[model samples]
Target: MTSQRAPLEPLVPHPRAPVVPQASIIPPPPLPPPAPASGPAPPHVFGLEKSHLLKEALEKAGPVPSGREDVKRLLKLHKDRFRNDLQWILFCAELPSLIQEGPQCGLVALWMASTLLVPPDGVPLDRLLQVALERGYTAQGEMFSVADMGKLAQEVLGCHTELLCGGLGGPNRDYILQHIIAGHPLLVPYDEDFNHEPCQRRGHKAHWAVSAGVLLGVVAVPSLGYAEDPELAGLFHPVPSTPYQPPPLPEEGFSGAIYLLSKQGKSWHYQLWEYGQVQESNLQLTDFAPSRAMDGRAYVVPAGGVRSGLCGQALLLRQHDTSH
Candidate 1:
């Protein structure tokens, strides 16, 4: 038995030949970036979307000119004309500087709206700009379409707003009169210099001004003038020069289309109510003509009565909220 066991042991050197290496695990490839957006972008309500656009525009904008004194003077003039305490409500607590390096008529319009909605403390420029930027009201800092402004009035002010057309000749004067009679100030976009034609040589731009009062059958609009031209700042010496230093008068004659606004039964229309009730006077559009600021240039109004984006033709804004 011992010998058999020894023989069995000797047979086995069969062996430990080779060790195979294991393969390491590999991760899958990274995913590719998302594809670019397709098709036309959806329309956005100004001051409600793409607010960054507003910020960019404000950042690149020129410095605001000093126009407080001008506002004060204008307010006084308005008071003298209206002979009532309501004049204060019509004018901004202080004139705002919207025109810096470029034409910011839309900004001017916002400021005007602030003057009406927030009294004593008018719309702060910084606050307005911040809101506009946050809301995406500005269009690449180039221009704010009239349609966007109407949307702003509704969303920001929580009030009703509308837009009307002036057609090939110009805006309807009667339409403007109706709004003014209704006690709503108008944001009118027009040629800054009606005396001059639209030409490259003039270097002028389309401008926005506020019509807050009526002067002897003419619209009383206070404007920011040459705010971008610091060199011309002196022209407004003592008091800053407003686009309409003397206010647009009927005698001056109009040269461009004017946009208008108002509400049908707003509480603010007490004066209009009085005119209609006591004087029995009609708010006739015939009395108003193309303001001196209009030089037959294209103006904007909301198309189809929808108040959210830009559209074709000159128009008026009419708010019908009776609450004021």
Candidate 2:
């Protein structure tokens, strides 16, 4: 007998076919607006409160001698002490007289500031030089004020930075001390011939050095330091065994100023900063008071804030009559 073949199942649609929803024409709700960015607040004074304290600092700021003989004497007097006192020191490798890289004290200062602030995205010195050159800051070459360099930095770094004029007795002495305490390195311009010495080369024009830090009570040198902690003391690698003594207080009328950069807070808030330049007269005199020129104020970058280029209007006045 032939086996019965299985009957073929008749075709039938499933009772539960997948349902298809009709497409809606309504649009999704719009996203919420972004939160506004916080910016620097108003400028305020920090550290010293009394004006007389600044006056005393000015009076005590002795004149720095420039003659090769005086510089040798000063270094001789302080050599052993500098190594013993400061935790570390910094000296620029480029000297204005020797370097063909244009007047680069300001550029060096910008590098120091970038290093000190330790910004995660800080630019390198060569990049800074390129940006500065592109920005026309180096047009005047070495004659360009530290203020101009500061302006260039403000743009490149996207922050507020400025140049403050005066010396030991200058009006902004108090202000300079305040920022240092707040952990800002100062770009000090001094008569390269008179104030800065022991460099491979020295010149009649101004030179820049970074005031890396300030010693609270132990005063062996001026406001800057290379190493932050006293316990980790060692000679600065670049300028090993070199003695750094700030020239005596600047003369009554000085031309250069300290380079300062403004810091942005989580919100709107800014700090003010200053100091003055070195004078040719300071090289000759040892007993003269801080110059009146140091008292004059100079603002090269005005001030950039949280938002980029906020201080654009302030920078319209680029060159200052810095020849004090």
lDDT of 1 by residue, 1-324 (tens): 011101011112222111122222122122223445897532211221224554455446433222333333333444343333211112212222222222344554555455555553345444544454445444222233454555555555544555543221223444444455344666544333232111111112343444443322223234433222233221121124333243242321332112122111101111111111111111111111233125332222222221112212222333444432
TM-score of each: 0.37, 0.37
Write one digit per residue (lDDT tens) for candidate 2, span 64-163: 2222223234235555433343332222211111112334445544554564443542455556666654554442223124445555555665544544
**Relative to the true structure, how large is the alpha-carbon lDDT of every model?**
0.33, 0.33
89, model 2: CA deviation in Å?
A: 15
The TM-score that candidate 1 achieves is: 0.37
216 Cα displacement, candidate 1 (Å): 3.2
Q: RMSD per prediction, one decimal?
A: 29.9, 29.2
